[model samples]
Target: MMKQKEAALEFAKLASDWEWRLNNLYYITDKEGRVIKFQMNTAQRELFKNMHLRNIILKARQLGFTTFIMIFMLDACLFRKNTRCGVIAHNQDDAKRLFREKAKFAYDLLPDFLKQMVGAKVDRAGELVFSNGSSLTVGTSFRGGTFRYLHISEFAKICCKYPDRAQEIVTGAFEAVSKDNVIFIESTAEGRTGYFYQYCMDSLNKHRAGMKLTALDWKFHFFPWHMDKAYTLDDPIIVPQRVHDYFEDLALKVGSNFTSTQRRWYAKKEETLGEKIKQEYPSTPEEAFEQSIEGTFYQRQFEDLYRHRRITKVPHSPASCVHTIWDLGVNDSTAIWFVQLVGAQWQVIDYYENEGEGLAFYKDVLDKKKIDLGYTYGTHLGPHDLEVREFSTGKTRKEMAQGLGLFFEVAPKLPVMDGIEAVRGLLPSVMFDQERTADGVAKLQQYRKDWDDKHGVWKDRPCHDHTSHAADSFRYFAICAEWLRDGYSSVVTLPATHQQQIPTGAWT
Candidate 1:
């Protein structure tokens, strides 16, 4: 009877204080292969509050952040009724370990009497269930079902591993989760490319500008190795000269004068990793995400445009003619980039995209661009692929469009790499409309080399994902614009009945 009273009092204490419950109840395997109590350090505690709900943390290695978040999510599943939480790892093996070795182990160590009160049971399907209806499941990916909580571990690695599927994964995961629930995505930097890098940059930019950032906007959490007190060595340590130079440069840039001990610890650690030390144990967020990944073709270009305010409001010019560039797809998405030549600048005034639509539908949209927006049509540019005859109509898309009076020119078919190079060269001369070309800008940002999982490296070939259509349209624009710049491209205006007509001049 006395033991039961004591158990009830302990359960009450655990139920009331989440922090205490976590530190006292949970256990994790330490580096020496012994289970230790799950107590969060000062840095971990600060990170917990910052990421209590929604976050994207770019952290140094071995900070136990992933472990701390796992326990927080487990707390939600145990204490709350009907709560459904998900933990997503980069792969199957990691997912299994996270669910079984971490989450399940914590639950299994709970007092037997306390487990009975919550009706805790081992779910055979890689989940923990309670009679009160709360549950936590772990998987490599989450789709279809709505979840109350979601934690994506090593998200940057996932982005590098599955570059093509990253967008789809993000879309599906966000849609499946309920509103106002915690969604934490934490990772160390893989490179200066990928979705994670972009996300952190955007968040950091917003936070720095003191903009209105909320739960809907992902909060940023960056943790350097020096923030952990344990990183300091007790004995005398000699720091390298390069480390001193780096800290000196960093102090000038970010106004951070780190202690000598931090430098010594980092220098000692760097000896083991050599050049990889900056990427692995960075002092600042910028240093962490500094190294550009190989095959990230447009990262520098994208950053330049963003930094220099190239992505801004480019209003429609009634005096100028609107030229539409297209990558037409039969069964897939067709993307159109509206470009208006303003003197020396290529003003990307708008963008439109659709799937499962005919040429007639697009024709209607182009007609509306003039009638509705009071802009005049200059010319429409399309890739050479539009000349391929269709099996159903026995006519090419360009031929069909001629009847609809939306004439298209066959852009000089160049190698894909050549087109990409042209786009890189042309980005400086181009200006994007923040509101109108927002989607197109994002497509440009995400366009990257596809990871060859079998070879464990990125291939030279592009990934045919959602971004492909839009990027292809932009590529077509670049190729045609190159012709214009080189004094080769001629805009031909064709009649409805396939009659020869005089070519038109450039839009002025």
Candidate 2:
């Protein structure tokens, strides 16, 4: 009798399990008979299960990122009592809608018995009140406060309204969570220099160092643009003829739809709707950022420069002798560029840059690099600063270089406009020797001007720093070249001439 009762109980439990699975709406079939399941790729799955304190999700669009995070937040609120979770969006309307939708969906799907655990009544303001004193609040980044679990949506956009608010909210609110607190910062790429972008990059660096960085506790998800299911990169028969034809047309107009490696897979999957849908949604953070943000640097000149290879160093000869361009610094990094003049072109050969070094150390490095002492160059400012009291050894910067057996030339103080124009003129004429001057070439390519739109003028301030050493050196060289051509003249003056008049010894 006891054995029979146990068997009967086991049979009932099995039946209950099957019934529960069948009743769950998330597992149920849609109108078309497709299961409404959370379809996550391998990467997305890892991100979902991640429990790092500081996490960042650099993801593409339409991979159910918002939904996944919503589920995670909900689980936290449900399981942890006396804990507050805050979801902040770019605006209030979005915050309200997203919170309400997810909460209602989760609420409606709960089993009857589980419904008893729902502590708080849903309010019009989109706040969820729980029985265990735990609550979930949805608010805009514009309104700042403390939160244990803080979710920032579209942080890149948040900067548009409250430029400093993003930083404030993260540091001020998330910092207070203190114990087992989790802060999630997820967004596609914005501009290269924005606060969100910087944060993401900083976190990435910390992660690489194997440090326990709160920022590294986050995950990054990136989906490629071509992963959309509705798009076909290749295949004429299995893929819809229209989508295939459209994709072909798009490829012709916008170049290849398939990245080099994906060409074959894209061709095979073209018949399937998965790639097309992914393309529409974008599976990579880079792809999403590219699609969502127009006029971004992602596909612009910045990308080109970033992808360009650095020039390498070559053997030194009298014909390709290296010259050093010096930009002296005290606390900041003093930069020196190794360069060679090839006909009209200047090829940067190498670079030595560092901060807070003694004059003797710099001299040793110069000696080691075999820098041409005669070719050492700097702006006229070098001579002036060489006269100032040194922070390290009470010697001027000029004296320091001289102590290293380097004879520094005080190239004339070319006006900022002249220096800018000279560098611009030299760029086209310059041909970088990739092997011999890797660092110097990098500095040249990275050199940029500070433009002022409001004043309609370029700033006269010197941009010479660690990266600008080579560029400043080239400018000084250019100025010296101009001076030498004009009989060592202090300033260049244009001679006025009549168009019709033909002077003797002057070729037309």
lDDT of each: 0.77, 0.53
lDDT (10s digit) by residue, model 2, range 1-508 = 9998997687457535522322232222233645364344454466655547767766544455566566566656655677778777777788877776665466556555445765465545667767776677777752344466778887766743354566666566666565567777766554343456556666666656776644434543344445444333344334334445645666775466644334444435433433222323444433434432332111233344334532223444455445555666667666665656556555555556666886677767876665543334322223224556578688766666666665565654545456655555544444444433444543454454443433333344544434455556566655455443433354432212211222222210
TM-score of each: 0.61, 0.44
Model 1 misplaced stretches (Cα beyond 4 Å): 234-238, 251-260, 293-300, 305-508
**Candidate 1 — worst ten consecutive residues by lDDT sum?**
493-502
* Model 2 alpha-carbon drift over 4 Å, by segment: 1-43, 142-146, 208-508
Give, for candidate 2, the lowest lDDT window spanning 10 residues: 499-508
Candidate 2: global Cα-lDDT?
0.53
Alpha-carbon shift of residue 165 in model 2 (angstroms): 3.2
At residue 146, what lDDT does model 2 achieve?
49
